[model samples]
Target: MDEVSPEETPSQKVPPWLFRAILTGAVALGGLYVLGWLIAELKMLIVIVLVSFFLSFALEPAVNRMERLGIRRGVGTGIMFLALLAAVGLFLWAIGTVLADQIGDFADDAPGYINDIEDWLEDTFDIEVDAQGLLDEFQEGGAVANLATRLADNLINLGATVLQVLFQILTIALFTFYLVAEGPKLRRNICSLLPAERQRQVLSIWNLAIDKTGGYIYSRLILAVISFLVHWLVFWLVGAPFPVPMAMWVGLISQFVPVIGTYIAGALPVIIGLLDQPSTGLAMLIAIVVYQQVENYLLQPKVTAHTMEIHVTVAFGSVIVGSLLLGAVGAVLALPAAATIQAFLASYLERHEVVQELEDAEAAQHPEREPLGDRLRQMLDRVFTPK
Candidate 1:
């Protein structure tokens, strides 16, 4: 073979367009890789913004009400924030008191309860349950196990969670404050970026989104409270243990996770009742079943309809799809996403007369060319004709 210099090869002398095309492809691929990372971070930022937006919306009515009574916006906002903080503190204190009482009760009766449970299961179901085996499996070490092992573990976890919650709360508060303060300016700036023809559409979309989000949050809060109170009263009536605390937990957690709330809410009380009293557990189960029917047929329709205007099928499908995508987070977000899509569709239908006209023109042009109908009509005409 002949020796080839570095620049003498035919392959080395690439066409300008070919070289540019390869360079472009490489640049595009690099840009896309960076974009994916940016999108993930952006999603986190959007979630934070949504949290703040909802908090501000929830507090807006209070702030506006305060302003109506002659308070300045700053003062109103501050007062509303303080009121929220105070309410949260009071709620936490109440929860702590109830939890402590429940814990003490459980601790005092745990051994007796365990013995009773073992005896009951053996007698009722002919099955032997080993309480010690469970305890032994859970017990893993010395100093960690010595200082009230479960309590220490719980406290450590709670402390970590509290710190995280505090950080989130601070982030939410800062975001909410700025959102409330600069909301109008932000809206204006966003609108200013669009062309004049699109400005209206943008504003409409923005308003619709805000309305839907705020409405969803408020409606959910109301529903959660209603569910909590109903479950608490029912559980108390049915002689379930820790009715208030368990009911509160069920209500809050269920509301946080959509579509499965009723089932999840029913589970804890039923389990506790089973452990405490089987007959009472059965009664509680029946009560929960009945209440879920009432809620599904009556309360959900009335509450969610006012907020979202989505069909029941759409709502259920959205929840399922959401759960499938992001687990619990997806389920929680699904209703809003559905509502947003519905709103977008409605807006498109309302604004796009040209689209409707085009569709109509196309339909008229095609006119369902029915050869059978034409032939049938012609035969009828021939038969009826007098010659």
Candidate 2:
């Protein structure tokens, strides 16, 4: 019987479903590859759109306020852009003027400054440095000539880079203008495609994003103003040249730029002060350090408490992540983005007060002390809300 069955060997067949499954998976994989390629190609476009949307969100509240006062959205958006451009122009003018004058003075007094440096080096460190000789060598070795040549060679690249940057800026500005002007219509169109429940959710999220962005801007502006006033007074007192421009530089850079902003901001004043008087430089440095500590401990917590309410660690982490993803622009966007996400999660998620047991246990572990963050939050809440 075994031999008879063997003699009638059956042919094996592939299942129809198996073939279909293999075909479907191949198609899916092909589709995914094309999708990924498309995304890679459009990455810059995506980033630009995202940035435009962020700017739109930040400007929406002001636009709405203007609308309430009977201004057309388009007009309000245009006004906002003009104001922004004017502010930028003013900042550039201040920076250019200060830098040009300072540089001119430095160049004119270069030999004296070099002699002073040499004297200081000899006096302080018993080290001899022929700065003039070094300068002569640098020039004679054709280093300056090479530098000029390099600059000449790269001039075209620099020009191209500048053009690219300008184009990007204009693209962002155009998109932002449209977004702000047509925000309501955009929202309506988006909601029209969604169900009633989903519409409400989308609208709420949109409004929350706008609030967070606007609040972020407001808080930063207030902090910048305070920083400007404080630094301006110190600079004026120290007889730092171009005190207003320097203070404005410090305020805007320190507030707007993250992480190294303070150091960058302080550099200008420090240099200007040193050029004026050593004692003045030392005093400016001390004042800046003191003000920074005060801001970190007192001012920032109080101001951000009402507006952003984002934890310090979270903000720092967001900035780091953002910088990793998109360099400087990402770093600048990080705060508002983090604030929006944090606010959204806070609103969407359920929360409960800490139990007395947990609090008691924490107190027992750290006897007469509370966390700095918690203390600051509680203190600021009390101060601001003052029952």
Candidate 3:
């Protein structure tokens, strides 16, 4: 074979446009990555938008029902908004009352709790304990003063956070109202952009996502109630202090959190029980474990399956990955995200050529025949009159 000349070399002959395209793609990808990072950094805004979207979907049925009852769309939306506000306010008030009572009880029993802790530590480790000495040392070193200062700072920060949260809620509510009012038009506008052939699939996927998200929210609310009741009953049976308050807190928090939620919720009861009586603490731990098992195997399956078909393994994995990426919020949002992703993938697969072929084959093999009446008439004619 003839040796290739320098000018004719394959690498040298590569088009300039190809190199330009590669460079342009690299820059575009880099910009997109940066943009994604910025969006992640603005997590609070993202959370508000997500909350608004989910709330709109969750409340749509109620709004529609109200409309069916001769209410105008605006009136229906307004009533839903007011109802939501009232519910939130009532929940907050209840939580506040319980927390106040628990705090007072804690204060009244502080000395006893401290003494019990000291006794347990001394006995368990076979060492002398000096609570007074530690306190004196802490005060002398100005640690207590520093702690007070830090607490004050934290309180101020917390107040600011509360204000910010209120603002976000107001924004979300306003946005949710608009979303509910204009959702139909918005949906139509979105579908109008897609090709006619693809619109049905796209709309189906959208419906699947909304239904799944709404179902998940409803199931979680139910689960929270069940968890609260079960925990409260168990705590009362075991004579755990502040059972109602603790159970409510545990239920609400665990519902918001994912994989590690049960453990966190179990911690408070166990600690309080241990402080009161060690044996009760052990019993409380066993109760928590058993209840979680039941919830996972029985309650969760029945409730969540109706909305989104996801495996427990997938849920757990999503939570783990989410936690690694964005802490508690990620873990809380993980299941919905996973379900949405799965819906998209499933819709895509259902539209694929292989899936269509398989379905067609199955249809051909089990072709639907005519009605029994038609078959009977044909059989009678063949038997009585046909030659």
Candidate 4:
């Protein structure tokens, strides 16, 4: 082969632009991968931030009202925080007390419940059950002792988890405090960087978000109160133990929690009822089902029509999608998020008035289409012919 100089080499013939393009592409892909890795690592932090932001939006209206009444934003936020903490503390206390008592009662009566269930099964399905013998075998096998040992061993892990949860709650509270107390400052700082028109647009969007979020909170609160009152009366009438806390449980969970919340809320009282008396459980179930129907048809529509302005199907879909993406947190945040997005889009989307009469007349006049060829010819003439 003939000798070739370095400049004449085939490799050297490659264009400079090709090398630069390859280098740039490699850098971009590497950066993207790094970004993805960081996001995965910081996923929990991202969820905390999102929750804080949602809470801030929900709290903004109250803070603003307090501000207008001449209270300092920080003070207002602190007051709100204290009130919220108090309410939560009360709720927890109620739940803890009732649950402790109820758990003890349930443990005591568990044998009776089992016996009843076995008898019912035997009577209804003609199946023989030797529950006492089975229980004796289970006791002899030391499964209960093993279970206790496992629970004791996991206590440390449970403590750590509780600490982790508290830390996350504190982090979210700090973020929410800053967001709400500095709401105006944050908006101003953001708007300062934009053009006048862009600033207006941003502010409008911010206001819209606040409205939707606050409206959602208020509407849910109203519904929760109504539900609490209704269920409290029913539970009281039915002689359920801890009616107040149980009603509160039903109210808050049914209103605030998404998807399976109602079932979880209703299941507790129904179980308690069933444990107490079958008739009580049946009544509880009937009341819950009837109330659900009334709320779906009457209360929910009237309350959410103005505030959420989102269709039921859309809300259901959003909840499903959110739950899939972020599990429980996403589901809780789905409604306000969907409402905000819907309102934002509605503002931007163009609309034209519908002419029902004209549409009906046109359809009546031309119920069937002409031949495809004739239609194509008309379209061609419309397009090709001069205006």
Residue 149 lDDT, candidate 4, scale 0-100: 93
Tell me the TM-score of model 4: 0.81
Write candidate 3's Cα lDDT for 1-387 as tens digits.
Answer: 999766676776879699899999999999999999999899888877776777787777677777889998888999888887886686677668866876888899888878888999999997788888998899999998999999999999999999998898789998899888777788899899999978998778767767777777778889999999999999899988778877877787777678767778888778878877898888888988888877776677777767666876998999999888767767776888788888788767656356888889998999988755456557768999956
lDDT on C-alpha atoms for all candidate structures: 0.76, 0.90, 0.81, 0.89
Off by over 4 Å in 4: 1-21, 111-145, 354-387
Candidate 1: which stretches are off by over 4 Å?
A: 1-18, 40-46, 57-71, 79-95, 113-161, 239-253, 320-330, 350-387
Best by lDDT: 2
By TM-score, the better pick of 1 and 4 is: 4
lDDT tens digits by residue: candidate 2, 28-101? 99999999899889978888998998899888999999999999999999999998899899999998999999
By how many angstroms RMSD does model 1 differ from the true structure?
A: 11.9
Winner by TM-score between candidate 3 and candidate 1: 3
Worst 10 residues of 4 by lDDT: 371-380
Residues 1-387 of candidate 1 have per-residue lDDT tens digits of 999766677777868798889999999999999998897778656666766776675566666667779987778888878877885686577557766876787899999989999999999999999998777766764544676878989999999999988887788899998766666677799888889889998778766766776677777777778878988898898888778877776666666567667677678678778767998889888987876666666676678768866876998999999778556656777776688779889878756356888889999999877555355557768999997
- Going through the candidates in the order shown, the clash numbers are 0, 0, 0, 0
* lDDT per residue as tens, model 4, 1-387: 999665686776878699899999999999999999999999899999999989999998999999999999999999999988998898899888888998899899899989999999999999889999998999899998998899988998899999999999999999999999999999999999999999999999889889999999899888889999999999899888788999989998898887787898899888888878899988888888878866776687778877776777988999999889788999989988999889888999998987999989989998977755456557768999997
**TM-score for each of the candidates:** 0.68, 0.84, 0.72, 0.81
Per-candidate Cα RMSD to the true structure, in Å, reads 11.9, 4.7, 11.9, 11.5
